[model samples]
Target: MNVLVIGGTGTTGSLLAKLLPHARVGTRKPVRDGQVRFDWDVPATFGTALDGVDRVYLIPPVGVADPAPVVESFLVRARLVRRVVLLSSSAVPESATGMGALPALVRTMPEWAVLRPSWFMQNFTGDHAVAAGVRDGEIVTATGDGRIGFVDAADIAAVAARALTDPLPHNTDHLITGPEALSYADAAAIITELTGRPVAHRSVSTEELTGRLATWLPPEFAVILAKLDEDIRGGAEDRVTSTVLDVTGRPPRSFRDFFRGFLS
Candidate 1:
């Protein structure tokens, strides 16, 4: 089955592309071999990326205030693609506005599966908010004692691959999560034990987090992140799910496993 993998250079997208070899990779700049120059902002490139593609692994643009318009326009021409697997957030409500409207939008497809994964385990390895602080021995967040079932990007991509290649699509939204829920303190301790780095988990207020993130991200995006932290602080995302094992026939990797992989 021909497939189109969006965000091909990104963490999960790169892994998904590797697993689904021969698939076209859609990126802003097609630098790597087999990568196609596809940008969500440029509709002119969609036809080339979607040509002969029966399936798609959709990765929405980050930091966009409203992704609905672009998503709507893309789907208008994505009529031939029978299957689409959308990467979304567990924190984004199906009824919420802005990017939160993504899940509901993809549901309009003929056969599609929406993956709402929580925080990724790659935060420490990649260029995420906590990565910079982890190396500096100070991981700061506003998520107090709340825990998150940090799903690994590998596992998320595995599920997406399965959704795209299976004889029948999952045809439903699933919340993907790791095996266990862990607090920031637990994460810091694990980093300290595994990397020999004296890491500390410093919890701040939502206001403080917004101010800190505003320096790097747009103010709106910063507020959205801080709001997610606020939800975590309220103990909203502190739970685990068995969807990973159910879909992949293998239990989700633990935080320790992801960390070890990062170290290697």
Candidate 2:
């Protein structure tokens, strides 16, 4: 099966691309020869790359307030494809974002699965804003003392691969999560233990976070993120789910292990 992986150079997408045997890895930049040209913003590029694809891993456009229209357009042409798997967030419903409408979109086909993964553990090791905050010895958040069950990107990728290759899809949305939940302070302590840096988790107002994020993110998207943080504070992401283990046949990695291996 020819699996077309959108956002194939990103954290989960890249990992999923490498796991699949016959995969077409899509990229916006011309990173190398044989990389398929796929950009969610450009509708003209979708057809050529989607041609002859048996299954697809759909990733919505980044920073766009609404990705439904773009994704809907692509799926219209990709109807011939047998299956599609979408990457979504666990906090989407609480934040009431565009991703909340995606499961219905995926269900338009016979075989489909939606993976709603929690905040990635990569937020610390990777060059994300959270990582920068950690490096600066402070991680600011509006999440107060609420806990998060942050899953690893690799675990999410493995589950995606399984969903794509399965003869009969699970045919439902799966809430993928880590084995345990931890507060930001817990994560900060783990970082301190690993890197010997006294990283602290600072509490801030949602409005403050929203304004600060607006400097980089679009205004609407910034507010959406701030709302999700508020949801986190309300304990939206505090539960652990067995979906990763159920799909991938192994428990998801913990945040402590992620920090230990990456920092060591």
Candidate 3:
């Protein structure tokens, strides 16, 4: 069956695309074979991407606080598709507003699965601001000492691949995470140990972080992101789960192991 992987060039999506045998990559620009042009803001591209697609692995639009409308429109057009797997955040609960609302909508499909993954371990080594801060010798956040169960993007993709191709739909949400919970400071110490670069974690206030983030993101999105840090500071993300093992039949890689390659 043809499977469409939306946001297929992104961190988890790209990995997932490689894992699926019959995957069509949906991106804003189609530069390679099997890569179709798709834009969440441009509904005109949805039909062509959905053509002949039997299932889909969906990643919501980046920086969109509320994606239900656009996603709903796409689902309406893709009603004939057999299964839909959504990538969501652990912080967002089912039926809540914004991305949270998507899980409920996906449940309405013939077959659906939701992956509520924790913070990505890649954020510290990839193109994110945290990675930039690490390059600048520090990791700045408003999360204080609160820890997060940062899972690797590859682990998330593994679970997504299974959800998209399993003999039957999972028909449930999977709370995916790594084996351990660690604060930004813990990650920084690990990075310093690996790279010998003396990286540090700098804690800041939510207001300060929001202002700093606003330099890159929209003011409203900056507020939301800073508030998520506040949630992390409250111990919201300080937990681990075995969903990766249960779903993928292998344990999720730890943050340290995932970091060694990037930092060392």
Candidate 4:
């Protein structure tokens, strides 16, 4: 089936593109065949991306506070598409503040699956902290002793591909977590072992971290991130779930294994 992957150049989207060659990847910039230029912020480009697409792997732009309207707009345009698989976050519950709207709209689709995955292991290697830390030898966060189940982005893509290509149960929200939970301190230790350097996970207070992050992230988002860190420290995402095994029929990859493969 022909599929459209939003954010197609990103971590999970890139993996999905590699796994499903026939799928059309949507990006804001010009891309190769089976890829179309599309932007979530631009409504006029939605039709071009959705045209002839049977399914979609929906990834809302990051740091978006209200994605219901964006998702609703996409679903309206993708009327012929059979299924939609949304990449959501485990931190925001369906009933929680600033988290319920997108998934709620997706449930209205004929067939939909919401993948609420835990913190991505790639956030360290690919995106923010770890890559910078690798360059500078320091990883800083406001999460003090917070253990998180950091799932691999590849695993998230696998589940998304299944949900898009296979006959999936409708309106299902799959909470995907890693095989184990580890704190920032634990993760630092693993990185230190892998890189053979004196890397550190420095814990900062919420106010200070928020102030520091304000330079990079929007003030509102920085505040949300700080709260999320506190929530992590409270052990909200410490438990490993069986969703990955149940959906993919294999054990979720552990942090140590992921670190060895990707970080080492």
Candidate 5:
């Protein structure tokens, strides 16, 4: 089946593209041979991206407060596609606004799966603010004492590949997570142990974090991120799931193992 992977240059999307070598990569700029020009803001690109594609791995536009309108437009054009898999957050349930609302749309497809993954373990190693702080030997957050089951991006991509290729469609939401739940402090300690560098978790108030994050992100988006941290502080994300193992037939990699692999 022809598959279109939106956000193909992104973390999990790139990994998913690698796993499915024949998949068409939907990106803003079509640099590579298999890449197609697809932009969420540009509705004209949707038809071209969906051309002859039978399956889709959907990643919604980032930082939009409610992406349902534009995403729905895209899906309307993808009516011919049989299977659609959405990448959503574990914190956002179905029927909720923003990414949460996407699962319901994917469910409308002939075959569909919603991947509700916890926070990514790559947050400390990617281009996010946490990664910048990690490089500076400090990780700052408003999440105080709350634990998160941070899954590896590769694992999330693995599950997506399975969901896209499995003979029987998984018409359900999958809560993907790593094996253990860890606090930001625990994450810092692990980084220090692994890298021989003193990494610290500096906890702050939600307001302060919002202000800090606003320097880099849009003010509205910054507020949303800060609120998510506040929710995490209240233990909203402190749990694990067996989605990676169940879908990929292998246990998800632990954060420590991920760090080791990243270091090497």
Candidate 6:
């Protein structure tokens, strides 16, 4: 089946693209063979990428305040496609104003699946925070003693690939998480064990974190992140779910296993 992967170069999207080699990658910039140029910010480019595509692995652009218009527009243009598998976050509840719209749209599709995965284990090694922490031997966050069920990006991608390739129920949401919940301190300890370094997990005040993030991200995004940290600290994402095991028929990878594979 011909598939289109939005954000094909991103963390989860990259892995999904690799898993679905026959899938067409949609990006804004010029891409190599088997890849198509498509931009979420530019609605004009949606048609070329969606043409003859049977399935889509949708990823909303990062730091977007209003994703509904973009998603709705894309869906309107790509009405011919059979499936649209959306990559949503566990942080976005069905009731949240900004985050709820896409999932709502997916409900109208002929066949769709929404993946609500918890914090990715790759944030420690592949993302900005983790890379910076690895370089400086310190991981700072506003989540004080909060446990998070950090799911692997690979597992999310596996589930997405399966949902896209096989027959599945439409308009379904999967809350995927790791096998266990761990705090930042626990993650730091695991990283130290893997790399044999003195990696410290420092708990910063929400105000301090917001200030630091303001230098890089927009103020609204910074505030949202700070609130999310508070939510995590409040034990909102500490629960482990069976969705991963139910869908993949295998236990989700633990944070320790992720450390072993990625850090070692």
Clashes in each model (backbone N, CA, C under 3 Å)?
0, 0, 0, 0, 0, 0
TM-score on alpha carbons, each prediction: 0.97, 0.96, 0.97, 0.94, 0.98, 0.96
The sequence of per-residue lDDT tens digits that candidate 4 reaches over residues 1-264 is 789999999999999889898888899995587779998789999999998988889898778776777777788888898788888889986753355677887787888899999999987787685568755778888788888989998888888878887765546888999988898889888888887887788888889888987898889988888888878878898878888788778888888888799854
Model 6: per-residue Cα lDDT at residue 41: 79
Model 1: residues >4 Å from true position, as ranges? none
122, model 6: CA deviation in Å? 0.8
Off by over 4 Å in 3: none
Q: Candidate 3, after superposition: displacement of residue 11 in Å?
A: 0.5
Best-fitting candidate, scored by lDDT: 5
Arrange candidates by TM-score, highest first: which order? 5, 3, 1, 2, 6, 4
Model 5 lDDT tens row, 58-125: 99999898999999989998978999999999888667677678888888889999999999999989
Q: Put down candidate 2 lDDT per residue, 1-264, tens digits, no spaces.
A: 888899999999989988985698888974765478998878888987798897999888888777787888899989678899999888877223476777778788778988899999999878877899898999998999999999999999999999999878778888998999998888999899888779999979999999988999889889989998899999999999999888878889989888888866
Tens-place lDDT per residue, model 1, 86-197, is: 9988888866568778888788888899999989999987788799889889999999999999999999999998998999878998899999999999999999999987
Q: Model 6 reaches what TM-score against the true structure?
A: 0.96
In candidate 1, where is summed lDDT lowest over 10 consecutive residues?
A: 93-102
Better candidate by TM-score, 5 or 6? 5
Q: Per-residue CA lDDT of candidate 3, range 1-264, in tens?
A: 789999999999899988984699999989999899999999999999999998999898889889899998999999679899999999886566787789888898999999999999999888999999889998899999999999999999999998988998999999999999999999999888888789999999999999999999999999999999999999999999999999989999988899886655
RMSD, one per candidate, in order: 1.1, 1.5, 1.1, 1.7, 0.9, 1.4
Off by over 4 Å in 5: none
